[model samples]
Target: MTHAPMADPPTTPAQTAARVLLGSAMVLAGTSHLTVARDDFQAQVPVWLPLNKDFVVLASGVVEIGLGAALLALPRERRTVGWVLAAFYVAIFPGNISQYLSHQSAFGLDTDQKRLVRLFFQPVLVLWALWSTGAWPRRRG
Candidate 1:
């Protein structure tokens, strides 16, 4: 009797590199949220939101570190991690918009044009998270 061929490994080197890069980015950003760049992150918080800016920054920083760690540690569950990360990116997008609309300067996005340009990068980050973790195509067996 003939046996079926084995499937390829779920993650390739490119995927691994993407994971590391994205994870590292998240960790660094999270660190910034909690420490030296806290004001920069706070500047993005929407004025209309009732939540305290510091609390939002602290919570999101914790989440970023957790998600970054999961991306690095959970090799078998990378896809799930990716979906969550993508969702996280989606959830935070309003901040990006707030920064643009309010003309709040943060992370060197001082000008209205710069803030507007920065707005477009959020979707790219979402895509990167999904692609890195093998969640974008809804992978099949």
Candidate 2:
């Protein structure tokens, strides 16, 4: 007996909502990176890096804003933007590690556990970025 081919999974409303939310969040966050919390970002840069905090902050802000805008603006470029955003996440990972190592206070949490918790979300953010881009592989019949 021949087996029947399986149908592609349907996109659920929830999934669509998630994509929209995630995309919106990225846009808002990227905008913030460009403006509102610009100084906060500069302070987050690891002191060990041999660069002025202002330059680093401005450069990173531009990248974040640009990537964020691209993700929102161009649907076709979603995959490319997702990869770039993922790279950005990975690139800044050391700053998170350094924050935890230094036991630096953030969001009013002094303990390393709080910082550790924040570090744990980095990968999640990366995944969200990828998902938002809708770049995951699909099975073909």
Candidate 3:
């Protein structure tokens, strides 16, 4: 049987820019999670969850910083980092939903429409994390 050809993985300037921007955003967001915006982040914690909101925020913040640094500093591990970061995005989606449902205004998401639209961006972020780090094409047969 003939084998299908495998093409080299590609990286574009746009992808590089996206990776840098997304990585920096994650670092900044993680910093906020630990520092000035800690209280604001608490608004997104679901009331149904039994865990302490502060602890959740702190833990997630630490995760964000680690993932961000990996994306930036670990070129060889970018694909793995991309996968982990995508899962992290998925894991935190509940917080976005919680924000929308509870009408908890934080950041610039001051209204229902804003919060709803912000919810849609989570998937985009997930995709960005994968695409920017070359994780998508690597999964092909």
Candidate 4:
């Protein structure tokens, strides 16, 4: 009986660059939450929510910064980071829905059309998080 040879582990300069670039982008984006559009971000918090708008914005900025830091700091944690980031995206989805449903404008996204555009972009951001962490791999059968 003959056994098939094992496949080599995947490694490419492009993959390395992709990982680094993606991680850097997340880190930068998360940091931006601290300052850029700060008021608009605070305003996005649901009015019925118990927390103060400033607190919400600050808390979310911290979380994003932490998550982004993790993605950049640990190589082994990339996959886990991807999953966590995906969950993060899922968690914040309601904010987007709320904005759309309420006809609310924030961060210069005025008009239903622009808000709808944001709705469409959210999933892409999620996918980008996934892709950044090398969550997707080509399957061979």
- Which has the greatest lDDT? 3
**What's each prediction's TM-score?**
0.90, 0.76, 0.88, 0.79
Ranking by TM-score: 1, 3, 4, 2
Q: Which one wins by lDDT: 1 or 2?
A: 1
The candidate that achieves the highest TM-score relative to the unseen native structure: 1
Clash pairs, model 1 backbone: none
Q: Which pairs of residues collide in model 2?
A: none
* Number of colliding residue pairs in model 4: 0
Question: Could you give me the TM-score of model 3 versus the true structure?
Answer: 0.88
lDDT of each: 0.88, 0.71, 0.89, 0.73
Error of 1 at 84 (Å): 0.5
What candidate 4 gets wrong by more than 4 Å, as runs, is 1-18
lDDT of 4: 0.73
| Residue 135 of model 2, lDDT score | 56
Give the alpha carbon lDDT tens digit for every residue of 1-141 in model 1. Answer: 999755324877898899999998898888888999999999988898899999999999999998998898887778889999999999999998998888898889999999988888999999999888887785469
> What TM-score would you give candidate 1 relative to the actual structure?
0.90
Model 3, range 33-104, lDDT digits (tens) per residue? 999999889989988889999999999999999999888887667778889999999999999999999999
